[model samples]
Target chain A: MNARGDTTRKRLIDATTALVREVGYANVRTRSIAVAAGVAEGTLYRHFADKRSLFYAAVLDRNAPIVAATATLPSLAGRGTVLENLLEVIRKLAQLQEDLLPLEQAMIADPTLAPLRGERVQMPLEGPPHDIARYLAAEQSLGRVRAECDPTLAAISLLAMLFGLAVHPLLGNDLAKSELLGASVSYFVDGVGASATQPKLLA
Target chain B: MNARGDTTRKRLIDATTALVREVGYANVRTRSIAVAAGVAEGTLYRHFADKRSLFYAAVLDRNAPIVAATATLPSLAGRGTVLENLLEVIRKLAQLQEDLLPLEQAMIADPTLAPLRGERVQMPLEGPPHDIARYLAAEQSLGRVRAECDPTLAAISLLAMLFGLAVHPLLGNDLAKSELLGASVSYFVDGVGASATQPKLLA
Candidate 1:
């Protein structure tokens, strides 16, 4: 990138990050970003083509590698117990910039953003379920996690718990909570499933 | 209760439920419910105190023990393997009347509805976390779950993933690909932790 282009790109991204954090994803736009950066609206065009493209760039810079590199690794392939490895991932994700939380979700959700989730951020091979499957497989091999257990469902339930902690603190709580921040990851590891009674079809 | 009181209470709830489903929570009010239910405006007052109280009553009805009892108690408490019990709870909760989905979130969110929560229902425990803690304790006591794990975080994470799945289906194609949901949960369940190689400190 040339000096002028590099300067423009930096300003554009800085403005986008600020606007998104100040307002929200739905409201952020190229025009506002350009104005915030004190650049001509057309300068934004020189830096990025459209809102979707700009938004994608922002997400890539902010969350793509951070979340992908960490979350999409061979996470399930831990030497320690499953709980320890899982807590490490949760803490890493929760600690990402608070500004990016809304943007991360908006990108992952919103089918409009689907095209952007491409070659740059390939999905991880050892997804949580795969890890659980590995764990369950290992445990089954060692005779711990029941072989008949639906590893997929177990994975889904566990993931839901982590997402809930993020959401409750972000969307529900009035003030940012330091104490509750790390609490969710810890609670899930304690393992609530083994004692749960068998569920029959509700008649 | 006299016939008039019984009829009035039923009419109010039916009216509010109908109104919310038809339009939305933001648009509905007692006057409209009263008009829809064919009760005089004051008749709405005779049965309910205000729009908040009326809406709270309807919200509770949708979420109350009668509807959830069909699944929550048995599934969460049952002796099934962890995943089986979770799937039972989620599947059943998914089957609840569509009106309830937004209702629970709206009541817990939106400060306008905060005061109403105190009036409509009292939680025996604060919320799902308590149920989660109890469940984890039981599992820990049974030596089924890892003793070192933090049950509270575990419970919250599970709740979060379930919430995302529930809302994801509403948000867009994210839910259509249960693969995404499954992957998310599975990773959380059996993911990696902070290590020298996979650092937790974010940029």
Candidate 2:
């Protein structure tokens, strides 16, 4: 926590970012990252537990936008219309996902990296969906969202849709992203039932 | 085209299955597959245009349950309750995805195998969603689904949820699969709107 230690942490993360961009995640190694950062290989172990944790820290630092947006989720629950708040969160998640695509592909390619992920393996399960579910539950308490609606499933559905939308372009599936998202969010908010009343989203 | 050619094609496919299972998709090569099948490496090119095509054919062959379920989609248009038919398709997709998980992970790991997938890259874009969209449109025509609903988005949402459910177990996200799925489909069919009428699904 000293200035010297903080500087070392920053240097290690920066080195990981540079090395990951240069060699790709599948090819990156702890010693190489240490070498790139101009530190002893043992220094990496001192600063971080493993390469996966190091990379996760780097990703979190890089994707501050999404992290910040997700943190503000509960505050937004009672403020804006539910659909608007949900869309905003999803939009941020999509942007973050777009940035993380290469890293995700690389991680999937390297089997050794999987077990190193440790606690981070459960991060995705606890991320935006968890926040969104909480937000929905809050809104339900406020009488904005339907009380009987299962917030967890709804949150998962929204998160899944956001993931699908984000990966669609990456996989060469051509979709009018913004337009389709608007429609999808509208559908989610209003439901597709014949008798369901559609709410007008704020501009 | 001839009996001899048919035998060769079957041999090549069988070879791919054995090789994929033995060495994994990231390690399988056309030459190794040919060597395993006791055929000239060039015989593989004659049977299939490339390794991706061969893998695609193998996946389709192995996933007969999903293909058969999908093929029966149109016949279910007005035959059963819309939710019943939709859940049936989703259940089949979940099973197929679970079966194909290893291959899917393997393919994601290997970059070289990507471009060879050709039109199959757009397979998800064209597969269950395409059929489901058509079925939903038909239901809309029959006054089952709301006419105002965007069938494409509905289909995509359902497909996305199905994919999430499929990958949840693979990624160690714990949810009661059937229960969560039932809630998801019900929410999709009835919407989360308090005013929406829910349908009774056949067991």
Candidate 3:
């Protein structure tokens, strides 16, 4: 596409995102999206296949930063202390979930978005959890982590903690913004068993 | 109310739960709920203030088992091994989250349910997380868990793990049905740090 076409496409995605946030996926109409983007209805179809496609594009566009941050997790495996690497992982995962959850909930509730759900392409062994697992496995090999621990399960546990915290407020509890992240990372790195004598790593 | 009134109210709640599960919350009508319950439309209103109230009743009805389970956690502290208590906690939390999440997403997406959202009564520092924290504190006092570990943060972390696993399938990832619950409980009871020399609690 030319520079003008690219600009129009970006505008459409931005408008769709804002409208979805304000109203909801079920109520958002393609015509209103075009109007919000200052483009013709015909132009929206010219750029994307359907409303679902356009919405998918908007979600992906919004998620680009998180994807980039998750991609960087594996490389940090042997470069830093495992505690430091996991703290960064938890921070990024929290941000990623916070951004994606509303959009995901909207998709689940809207029948029109069913096609997008069917088309969901999962990388399976290549998300943040998998990346963290790979990092832990590497750390285990380097003798930084316990040899008996299951890296995959540990990764899932870590991911679960962050995801749980992200959705806690939806259940009417206040978002726990205390020293939870640091404390969790510290607990994870140094086992909570009475015999485990590692000094406290986080304040 | 008399036995007949109790039976009628139970029928209405059961009908509402079935209908809401079949159709999204936005699409469910009180008229349909009454018909499904084999009662007059006036019957539903007589039993409840509005559709939101009926829906709330249904949610609470479904959640009673989880509430009962969560209520048992604090009393179990120091009665059995700390590991055994936590394993039970993870099991109950995972079940609670799995059942509550779909209803929650529907509530979040539908505008008519906005009033119900505001009416959410939280027990604040008295739910499962708090209960588990109390248990941990009791165990810490008994010298079963490390003194330096923060019980509140540790409780939060354990809850986060189970909640995360419950929601993982929503993102198109297959529900991880491996030995995750056992693994997480073991990790929580015994930290993953290299120097933590407790025997692995779970296989």
- Using DockQ as the measure, the top candidate is 3
Q: What tens digits encode model 1's per-residue C-alpha lDDT throughout B33-123?
A: 9899888999889888888788778766765642443324333443755444444444444445244545543443233555532343642
Worst 10 residues of 2 chain B by lDDT: B193-202
Ranking by DockQ: 3, 2, 1
My TM-score estimates for the predictions, one after another, are 0.54, 0.72, 0.81
Give the poorly placed runs of model 3, Cα more than 4 Å off: A108-126, A170-178, A191-203, B108-126, B170-178, B192-203
Each model's fraction of native contacts: 0.25, 0.31, 0.56
The most accurate candidate by lDDT is 3
List each candidate's DockQ score.
0.15, 0.30, 0.45
lDDT of 1: 0.52
Residues A21-60, model 2: lDDT tens digits: 5556655789998988888989889989988789877766
Q: Can you write out model 3's per-residue Cα lDDT over A107-156, one digit (the tens) per residue?
A: 65554555443586432223666677877777776666767788888887
Best by TM-score: 3
Candidate 1 residues A1-203, lDDT tens each? Answer: 79988888877877887775565444567789999989999988977888767776776566554445344434354355545665566555555535454554444323344454244642211244455445544533433343444655555454444444444423334213344445554443423222123331221
For candidate 2, the per-residue lDDT at A49 reads 92
Chain B, candidate 2: TM-score: 0.67
Order of quality (lDDT): 3, 2, 1
What's the lDDT for residue A110 in model 3? 56
